[model samples]
Target: MKINTYIDHTILKATATVDDIKQLCKEAKEHHFYAVCVNGYYVALAESELMQTDIKIAAVVGFPLGATSSYIKVEEAKHCIDQGAHEIDMVLNVGLLKSGGYQKIIEEDIRAVKKAIGNNVLKVIFENCYLTTEEKKIACKLSLNAGADFIKTSTGFGTGGATLEDVQLMINEVHGSVKIKASGGIRDLNTAKQYIDLGVSRIGTSSGIQIVNPT
Candidate 1:
C-alpha cells in the first residue's frame, strides 16, 4: 500500500510559526503525503503553499479541547473552509458525552458543522484516550448519524493516544459506513502499517517522513 498517501502530515502545536508551516508544506510536497493538517489559523497559508499541488489541506476545529460552544465551533469550521481547508477534523464534545444525556446536542453540533461545510470532508475526533469502550462506540454512532466522513482516534494532546483495541472497536462500531483515521503516538513505519492493515484510511502524524524513511 502507499503509506505516504495515507498520511495527513500534521503540525498543531500552539507555538507553530509561519516558517514551521512552510516547512511542513515543504515536507508534505516532498513526501507526496495525502494532506497537511494544521490548526485553523494556518489553513490559508497551507492552501497558498500547497496550491498547485494535489495535496489537500485539513484543519482542526475546537482543537484539542472539545469544550467550545457549537456556535464558535461552527464559525471556526466555516472560517477554515473559507480559508481553503479541504477537510475538517473536529473534536467531539467529550464533556457533553461524559456528562451524559447530551446526545442530541452533540449530534446537532456535528450536524451544524457538516451543514456549514457541505460536502467537504468532516472527521470527528473522538479523543479515544479519555473515553471508555462504550463511549467510543457512542461517539462513532453520533459521528455517523451526523454525516461524518471519517471517525478519528485522538487529538494527540490528550492524556493518551491511539491503541489497536480502540481502532478495532471503532472499526466494528462504524460497520464501514464511514472511514477511520488513527492518530497520535504513531511514530514508526511498523506502527503505521499495523493501523493501515486494520483498515484505517488515514494516519495523522508529524513523523510522516520518518515513517517513510527511517534512516
Candidate 2:
C-alpha cells in the first residue's frame, strides 16, 4: 500500500516554531503525505506553505487536556477553521467522560466542535491512556453520535499513545460508520502498517519521514 497516503504528518509540540512548521510542510509535500497536523497557531502558516498542493492542514483543539469548557473548544475550532484548517483533531472531555456523570456534556462538547467546523473533517481524540475499555467504547459511541468523522486514539502527548488492542476495540465499536485514526507511538513502517491493516483510515504521527524511509 502507499503508506504515505495514510499518514497525517504531525508536529503539535508547544515549542514548535515557525521554521518547524515550514519544514513540516516541505517534508509533507515531498513525501506526498495525506496531511500536516499542527497546533492551532500554525494552521495558517502551514496552509500558506502548503498552498497549491493537495496536502491537508489539520489543527488540534483543546489539546492534550480536554478539561476546558465546550464553548471554548467550539470557539477554538471555529478560529482554526477560519485560519484555513481543513481538519480538526479535538480532545474529548476526558475528565467528564471518566466521571461518568456528564455523559451528555461530553457528547455536547464534541457536537459543538463538530458544528463549528461544519463539513470539515472532525476527529475526536479519546486519549485512551486515561480511559478504561468501557470508557473507550463509550467515547467512540459519543463521538459517532456527536457527528465526528473520525475517532482518534490519543494526543501523542498523553500518558500513553495508541495500542493495537485499543484500535481493535475502537474499530469494533465504531463499526465503520465513523473512521478511525491511530495516533501516538506510531513511529515506524511496521507500526503504521499494523494500524492501517486494522482498517484505520488515518495515522497521526511525527515519524512520517522515518516510516516512509526507515533506512
Candidate 3:
C-alpha cells in the first residue's frame, strides 16, 4: 500500500515556529502526504505554502486538552476552516464524557463544531488514553451521532497514544459508518502499518518522515 497517502504529516508542538510550519508544508509537498496537521495559528501559513497542491491541511482545535468550552472549540474550528484548513481534529470533552449522563451534551459539543465546519471534514478526538473500553465505545457512538467524519484515538499529548486494541474497538464500534484515525506515538513503520492494516483511514504523527524513510 502507499503509506504516504494515509499519513496526516503532523507538527503540533506549542513551540512550533513559522519556519517549522513552512518546513512541514515543504516536506508534505515533497512526500505527497495526504495532509499536514498543524495548530490553528499555522493554518493560513500552511495553506499559503501548500497552495496549488492536492495536499490537505488539518488543524487541531481545543488542542491536547479537551477542557476548552464547546463554544471556544467551535469558534476555533471556524477560524481554521476560514484560514484554509480542510479538516479539523477536535478534542473530545473527556470530562463531560466521564461525568456520565452528559452523552447528549458531549454529542452536541461535537455537532457544534461539525456545524461550524460545514462541508469540511470533522474529526472528533477521543483521547482514548483517558477513557475506558465502554467510554471509548460511547465516544465512537457519540462521534458518529454528531456527524463526525472520523473518530480519532488520542491527542498525542496524553498519558498514552494509539493502541491496537483501541483501534480494533473503534473499528468494531463505528462499523464503517465513520472512519478512524490512530494518532499519537505511532512513530515507526511497523506501528503505522499495524494501524493501517487494522483499517484506520488516517495516521496522525510527527514521525511520518521516519515512517516512510526509515534508516
Candidate maximizing lDDT: 1
Q: Write the per-residue lDDT of candidate 3 for residues 79-172, one digit (tens) a residue.
A: 9999999999999989889999999999999999999999999999999999999999999999999999999999999999999999999999
lDDT by residue for model 1 over 86-114, one digit each (tens)?
99999999989999899999999999999
Mark the 10 consecutive residues where model 1 has the least summed lDDT: 129-138
Residue pairs with backbone atoms closer than 3 Å in model 2 (clashes): none
Query: Which 10-residue window in model 3 sums to the lowest lDDT?
Result: 62-71
- Mind giving the per-residue lDDT tens digits that candidate 2 earns over 4-116? 99999999988899999999999999999999999999998998999999999999999989888888898999999999999999999898888887888889899999998
Instruction: List the candidate numbers ranked by lDDT, top first.
Output: 1, 3, 2
Give TM per candidate.
0.99, 0.99, 0.98
lDDT of 2 at 99: 89
In lDDT terms, how accurate is model 2? 0.94
Roughly what TM-score does model 3 have, to 2 decimal places?
0.98
